[model samples]
Target: MVARRRRGAADADQYKPEAHSSDGAVVYVRVQEDGEFVITDDDGQPYDETELRVLRKYAGEGMRDMLQQACDRLNADLSALATVHCDTLSPRDKPAFQSRAFPEPEPQRNPLLQPTLWSRIWPPARRRLEEQNERRAEQYTRAFSEWEEAARAFNEQERQRREQETELVLTNLDAMANILEEHLGEIPWPRETSVSFDLGDDASTIAIDIELPEEDAFPDVEYTLAAKQPKVSVKKIAATRRRMLYRDYAHGVAMRVLGEIYHRLPTVQVALISAYVPTLDTGTGQPTENYLYSVLVTKSQWREINFKALANIEPPATLERFELRRKMTKTGVFKAIEPFDVEALANEVGI
Candidate 1:
């Protein structure tokens, strides 16, 4: 039985094979051509032939079976990793919109006190004092009224801002599109990719169009050597062999965009993703032409799929729900595959 090599052990000899037993004992096993067995315990120290002979004499016959069983158990554990369930949910900070604080209005106070008895003795003085007090009271009342109006306006502005932040709006859709573009731009690709979101009147459904790099930007297959030997040439892969690789790449990109939209934006229920590659037109032989591939999937439908398990499946098999069209190419001529119409889907859903 084969076992993993033990770490941090001293080199006992240059010729013997070292191994660990099931009981955590490290030993070296050697077979002689004359049908003799040599075994020695390793105690992080070197042992001569005399010490080895003593160790072999004391070693139990049952130790070999024990080590074999341990190795079998380790292999069994490793093989179970393929279908193991994992929690892959990633937590992100919820988006927040803050409103600026409005300035507080100054206090409006009474400008006059009680009239004095001396002022009351003269009618003109008393009248003048009473008129001054009336004027001051009017100014105070007017100032209070202006402050109340300012407070009401501030409150209304805050209410509208809060609604814009939480509810869907066309202006907010532009902001969301900008965010999608910024995120897609960060992908490690040759071209600057972007995505635009168009929200419908229904609010739950969103149409997305993503710009993808040219197909030529991706290599068909990578060359590699079968063995690490001198003067060995690397194996060349056929173009047909790499077809699945390109399909899988496109599939992964679509899934990533879907995850970002449905999970990050909780308001979105159904997302229709259209990915297009800008390349030279085959018919006109002109640059800056597009070949598009589109898929429509609901958030509920995607949530039912096991993403981890689906990762191992072929792209076409995993993306069967999209009803994706197949591209056709023949002898340097290419035909574009039309995607499902987003407007028709919206109308069917009564959006």
Candidate 2:
């Protein structure tokens, strides 16, 4: 029977004509002009059945491991779309500062206090004890003064840092953008993605634009091992199922962005977020971007969502609760639409 070659085993001499016997013996079978099968090695000698069986067993095991790894990778990519969470920030609490403690000097004992009565009564010993005690006291005072100066300087520096952090959380637009970038950058996306942020004249409103991955970026096939042979079967993903996955991934990204903004920027009242993909314009025949969806999420409505139950929530259904603009077909295919203008939309909606 004909069998496919194992993946990554590219040595032509090793797998000339792929075949395996009923008892799991690895044999290279060639067809003659008379339609008869001949099992032979690279030098055309008859293959030893004992060696063939051993090779077949190990090849089967390797194929099973490879198949398992491929399945796990696909599952991880799919799960990444639905799992997004972040720690929230609070501006009311003061940043914690670690203060340095004062260093205490060890107590010194007078060497003149010997067990002998003469040594204790000696006048020179008494004078030496006094001098030693005075020097120890002076050294301790100097150390204490230095420690006080250092503590004051450290406290002042920490105070300025805390003030800067509080200001950024309250009203600094540039600082807010930087912080947002850092938070968003930390997300482990399945594909390459880029994002940009804009702050409106009103400090509480913000806009976000995301460059989504193209449709071709997703995996379009699944791998499985053959039941009887050490071979892999690659099956194409159905068109409808792929479309649904794309829609879910896109919506999931949108939901994650909204969640991060509300959690990280405590003062943001409204967010205008849009996602788009790079494409060639039909009319101009030039490279351009197509906006897939745009949404306006308000902080008040977002608060009602149960963040703890995010795993059970479907991203596309969750987005239906907001003011959204999208042109998706019944089969989950998206069409281009114009993105929202941050200030104008806010003023029109009285948000």
Indicate which candidate wins on TM-score.
Answer: 2
For residues 1-351, could you state the per-residue lDDT of candidate 1 as single tens digits? 111111111122234545554545677644332223345566445457775444445543333433333333323312222211121222122444556776985656885957789787988888989999998889888988888888889989788765655453324554454444444444432223455566655445777666654545344322222232211122333555344334444455566567656544555567777666667767887875354567777766667666656535444454567645546332122346676677755743532
How big is the RMSD of model 2? 17.0
Candidate 2 per-residue C-alpha lDDT over 1-351 given as tens digits, one digit per residue, 9 for 90 to 100: 111111111111222444444555454554332223345554677757776566556554543444444444444454554343222222212223233343444334333332345536897876776677677677767777777687777767657545544566567766566556656777666667677777665557778888888877766765554676544455687888777777877887777777767766667788888899998989999999999999888887788777767767777777789888999986679999998886554663345
- Sum up the clashes in candidate 1: 0
Worst 10 residues of 1 by lDDT: 1-10
- Per-model TM-score on C-alpha atoms: 0.45, 0.60
* lDDT against the true structure, each candidate: 0.51, 0.63
